[model samples]
Target: MWQWRIVGNGGYTKIQNVASGTFLDLFTGTSMPGIQVQGWARSASESQDWFLRRVSRSDVEIREILARDTHNAANFQGFRQDLLYLVLPKSVRDAIYVKSGLKNMKDRGQLFDSDDYAFFLKVEVAKWGVNTLLADDFGILWGVMFGQKGNHGLAYNFYLNENLDNIMFFDPYTGDEKVDMEYKAYLAVY
Candidate 1:
């Protein structure tokens, strides 16, 4: 039976078994993977904390949910509107799109397919530098790479408070080895 649901993001999570009010715990609080696991009371112990190693294309459904529902509205409430304010004119949008590599694109889905998708967003974000203050907005942008290891899915970082340290742990696609380290470092520099 499907009885477990993950609470919290890929960074630090607690898998709760709905059938019982217990969380999935690492047996004896072992730090390595493939260790024995069991259900235990919610004690906020280190054993109960888990990190999602990857997000793949097959997890698009999960990604979409996190994107749409988990994002902190306070951080992004006016971001799109503000972006529009700067690039709403047809000419401006077209130019920014072309610079951001959105020209000839039929849908947003293609955005997920591009290797330079973040760079595209960066172009757009760069355009607003003079008009908008986006220091806090960078976190959400960094999250865009959340599941990129699985090969560019529709998921863009909607989960909040994501950072380099936590994101590096997620493989997202294979849930195996960590990927996109260079890109993450690049963004950190950007």
Candidate 2:
């Protein structure tokens, strides 16, 4: 009985409840890889019957009760792979890393490696521990909102650019200042 907004182009491209047999057009009706499956209204087509289970207050797990006769795409680019699960694209990951000063330090041999990125995120969160959850929540919402609203354009825009360092100081959230963990937390709750 949950409602989900469907994104992408194809046979399905609108908001519909899980009970209704509405299938997401992962390929946007075009032949592409990594097409995603989304819940829609029931059309009696077996594609819409889904089992929605609550995993946590802020998370839900969706399982398809009936397999719809749809072509599953591999490495599908824009569609959401899992419900309530945010996959950080390379661009978004890089943007966060660069903006948080992880990239610059890496070049200086001061901070290089995946561990550094993890530490950076952790330190950023610790600086504003009160807002850590909020920031994480905001990041999740931004990830999903961007996916649904712009077809992952925000993700790509922030993530897939050569001059990441150039815009590293630019914060897309406020537009006036570069995005910081504190700012992200503020935005998350507000």
Candidate 3:
């Protein structure tokens, strides 16, 4: 799975779904002041739509000018050819696999385990320049969920610690916390 961060001018209020090419309105189209924006699908506008801005082989940023979907709501989900344009830094990728505890014996390695729900998250204390420990932790949590293993509730709790409070919240639908508490839990078990 790939994710993107979109930035635009003015106050666009939606994150465009690259696959469907439809814009998803963020904040229910209220456009509150000082709120972060995100990406969504909107049938009638491109004001907040964006194109890719390559930062490196593993890092590309999205540029646009809308307020919608600019914040937590703009995060891209699943795999999509169009959305792949947002490249992640090689270091970030490496950190993901490492933190997930997936042995990278060879230069080429698999990103996830068989269940596809769990991953080894690498936390490089030295690589804190461009990456944050919290960010890597969230990546591991999300990767597991995307792979369909960790409970949604657990993932949400970990996400909140990673600063994802804007998108999800505590709810009855939350799943087992034991699996989603943190990647450290898995390490302790092993």
Candidate 4:
């Protein structure tokens, strides 16, 4: 289903679709761990170059060697842990930390649904008055004008801000905050 050949002695390889002839590539301005790979025309860019690391006789890991590598190979585990701290809630983080034992900060952000993430944001905004959601994944498609043919171009959240907190939300529907008083005013129970 796929074929590849090394590009001379430059230590780069081009993987091709046997049926389509397109090479595996990282979309420009959007190369990071956990991001999806795409198929594009062959080029001399390093985004298309891959490093093959043989973990065992039968196991090999394909790594993309971009000009600016975000991951630190020497401390990969620590990197993943730090990523968890940036996105996960305190309760979920504590649970994963306890369950993982020596696993450090385990990622459970993907497990949460939209409502769950929204609720977490709601609670955080109420309790700490935080304004933004600091995230680890940079795969969001923003400002995209789809199906416009040459007029439409793709845009991504290649967040290069000093704080790196690109996504911010403010709840407009929620009314005044409620607190427990002497008399229990019970609303509709879920």
Q: Estimate each model's TM-score.
A: 0.30, 0.25, 0.21, 0.28
Model 4, span 83-177: residue lDDT tens? 11122333442342244232232335456432333344334332331334353332211111011113432111111112323211211113111
Candidate 4 structure lDDT: 0.32
Q: Of the candidates numbered 2 and 4, which has the greater lDDT value? A: 4
Better of 1 and 2 by TM-score: 1
Candidate 3 lDDT over residue span 1-190, tens digit each: 5334343534443454555554544344455676555545544555354354333211111111111222222332422122212223445544544554435332232343322222223122224423543433112222222212245222222121122212112111222223223321121100
**lDDT minimum window of 10 residues, candidate 3:** 58-67
List, residue by residue over 31-143, the lDDT tens digit for candidate 2. 34665665433344434433432222122221121011021122222322324423233454445545665434433333343333343453443344344344343223122
Each prediction's whole-model lDDT (CA): 0.42, 0.31, 0.30, 0.32
With candidate 3 superimposed using the best TM-score fit, by how many Å does residue 38's alpha carbon deviate from the native?
Answer: 6.2
Kindly list the per-residue Cα lDDT of model 1 for residues 94-176, writing each as its tens digit: 34445544444434455454334544555564565435554432212223332223343332221122222122222222222
Task: Rank candidates by TM-score, best first.
Answer: 1, 4, 2, 3
In angstroms, give how far residue 116 of model 4 lies from its true place. Answer: 41
Q: What is the C-alpha RMSD of each candidate to the true structure, in Å?
A: 17.8, 18.0, 18.0, 21.3
Instruction: List residue ranges in candidate 4 displaced over 4 A.
Output: 1-9, 58-190
- What are the per-model numbers of colliding residue pairs? 6, 13, 40, 0
